[model samples]
Target: MSEVITGGCLCGAVRYRCTAAPNNVGLCQCERCQRQSGSAFLMATVFARDAVEFERGELKVFAAFDDDGQGLYRHFCPTCGSAVMITLDRYPEIRSIMGGTLDDKSWLKPTYSLWTSSGQPWLVLPPGIRLHPDYPDGAVA
Candidate 1:
């Protein structure tokens, strides 16, 4: 079992706790991730949906579709505009937390890259790290 990880949004409008370790922590090079994160890619940490819980405010969700046109929920704090969490329809059992929103991002690092083939030009991922042409193995657990 992984240690419990706790974090909240920029303005504390959204708070969350995870009782188990993330199944995956990685960068997403998909176009939607780039656009939503406003960066080269989105740094995300995946956990079981059942392992996460909100302590206070609720997240406002904006549903997005992946390249395959599948639903992906982008969750954020309506009051702070901070990107907090996500849930992909393609991988229903997983919940991904935006790593940047963590109080201490020092411990969070991508173990791999997702959607590398769709990655933006000029975005160079770390050498030798696993790059999933699509979703990585065990992303939903």
Candidate 2:
């Protein structure tokens, strides 16, 4: 069996577990991601939708649409307002966990970065990782 991954919100109001390994892990520097994260970028760990289970608390969802009219749902802890997860209409089968929320982050190694066009001018990307101005061909945002 795959090792389970666990994480939660800042106030401990929300917790979750992933039953399988992540499908992908990447950084997003899109304007929406930067604004939502209050940072230069958002590190997202992608997993199969069915693999994630909310173990405690409830998440308040904020839904927004992309320029293409696709849905982008941001799920956060209401108590602490910590962005915990994201779901996209463009990739219905995946759930993206906020990498900063992971209880154990020592294992994370992002392989690519998306929306580099919007990335901060002073921020230097990791060495040798794939970089995309937008979403990679057929990959999640």
Best by lDDT: 2
Q: State residue 65's C-alpha deviation in candidate 1, in Å.
A: 3.8
Candidate lDDT values, in order: 0.82, 0.93
Compared with the true structure, the alpha-carbon lDDT of candidate 2 equals 0.93
Candidate 2 on 2-119: residue-level lDDT in tens? 3889999999989999999998889999999999999999999999999999999999999999789999999999999999999999999999999999999988888999999999
lDDT of 1: 0.82
In model 2, state the lDDT of residue 78. 91
Minimum summed lDDT over a 10-residue window in model 1 is located at 132-141
What total of clashing residue pairs does each candidate reach? 0, 0
Error of 2 at 107 (Å): 0.5
For every candidate structure, what is the RMSD over all alpha carbons to the true structure, in angstroms? 2.6, 1.5
Per-prediction TM-score to the true structure, in the order listed: 0.85, 0.95
TM-score for model 1?
0.85
For model 1, the superposed segments whose C-alpha errors exceed 4 Å read: 66-69, 136-141
